[model samples]
Target: MSNKTIKIGQLDMELQSIFSAFEHHVHTAVDTAAEKTAEEAVKKLKKTSPKNKRAKRGKKYKNGWKYKKTSEGMTVYNEQYQLTHLLENGHDIIINGEVRGHAAAHEHIAPVEAWAQDEFPEEFKRQVGKG
Candidate 1:
């Protein structure tokens, strides 16, 4: 990347390569930031995830939180997939296929999501600075 003053044959190619490299650098930084933020969210979710002692379940949902990288980006999921939405948003108490009542929503995901939303930018900045 010179001054781009006088006419140069390789100037265009050089500029393209430079820009592409910078783009790649930024993309890597973003991905790093996304992963860190996602990990933080997963940890927070695990800590805050509810443990229903009364239910004769195998274990607490606390340990099931995990994050994965998708084509779109990072995705946080519970290994206990069947209970995630039900626990987060509350569910209808069904008895033999009949809705009897509603379970109270014990919000464990939303707060972490909000924190991630606020944390990603800072994490991106930190990653880029390190780069």
Candidate 2:
């Protein structure tokens, strides 16, 4: 019996191509998932944000909510003013060196955290397929 040898160069090339495609797929999937999650978080924050009663009668905190994609992940933020931190965390309202009262925390980030916890893993799994 004669033994035959086979070259796997073509097979290797095919595998490399498949892997490249898979990598691109993963990147796209992650980006899409992150974008969707960020948008959802913004929506949730807008809906739940406490309205500024002191502002113009029909003014809404919802209008402040915005989102953008970041290198590490996604970011949801408020654009109305730099008051998101103050609104999310209770702060003392001081007047003329007098402490008036504490503003209650609205906690916009908490909902985003909760949403990411529920969404990210599921989205990754669905996009990339089971590891």
Candidate 3:
């Protein structure tokens, strides 16, 4: 009769366990990674948004943008609202929405200029005075 013993090292056993665990949770790992990325993005956004004082608010997500509220505001994600650029005036003041970016010309509304000038007295004054 012959007898033989097979031995696996501690490191090899640990590696096997880790690989098995990783394989078992592969789908969860991917989902968790995506969720974490989204969570981080929201956290970054919360840092910049006004705490709680907007009758209305807006977000712009185009090409690395930032928003600073001089006054209180509120926003509903898909709703379009009026916006004026701080740097550009050649184009008429436009209306925009926060789909995935900060305000830009692509979502601009031509009629919003009239509304801003006529309806939002204070906002209209400030923007016009800026010119």
Question: Which window of ten consecutive residues has the lowest lDDT sum in model 1?
Answer: 1-10
The C-alpha RMSD in Å for every predicted model, in order, reads: 2.8, 5.2, 20.2
Range of the 10 consecutive residues with the lowest summed lDDT in candidate 3: 73-82
- Show where candidate 3 strays beyond 4 Å: 1-21, 49-91, 94-131
> Which tens-of-lDDT digit does each residue in 56-100 have in candidate 1?
773557788889999999999888899988999999999999999
Model 2 over residues 29-131: C-alpha lDDT tens digits?
Answer: 8887788777887777877777877768434566778888777788777776667778789799999999999988988777677878799778877877733
Q: Let me know the TM-score candidate 2 reaches against the reference structure.
A: 0.82
Ranking of all candidate structures by their lDDT, best first: 1, 2, 3
lDDT per model, in order? 0.89, 0.77, 0.37
The most accurate candidate by lDDT is 1
Q: What is the lDDT of residue 38 in candidate 3?
A: 36
Find the number of clashing residue pairs for candidate 2.
Answer: 0
Q: Which rank order by TM-score, best down to worst? A: 2, 1, 3
Error of 2 at 125 (Å): 1.9
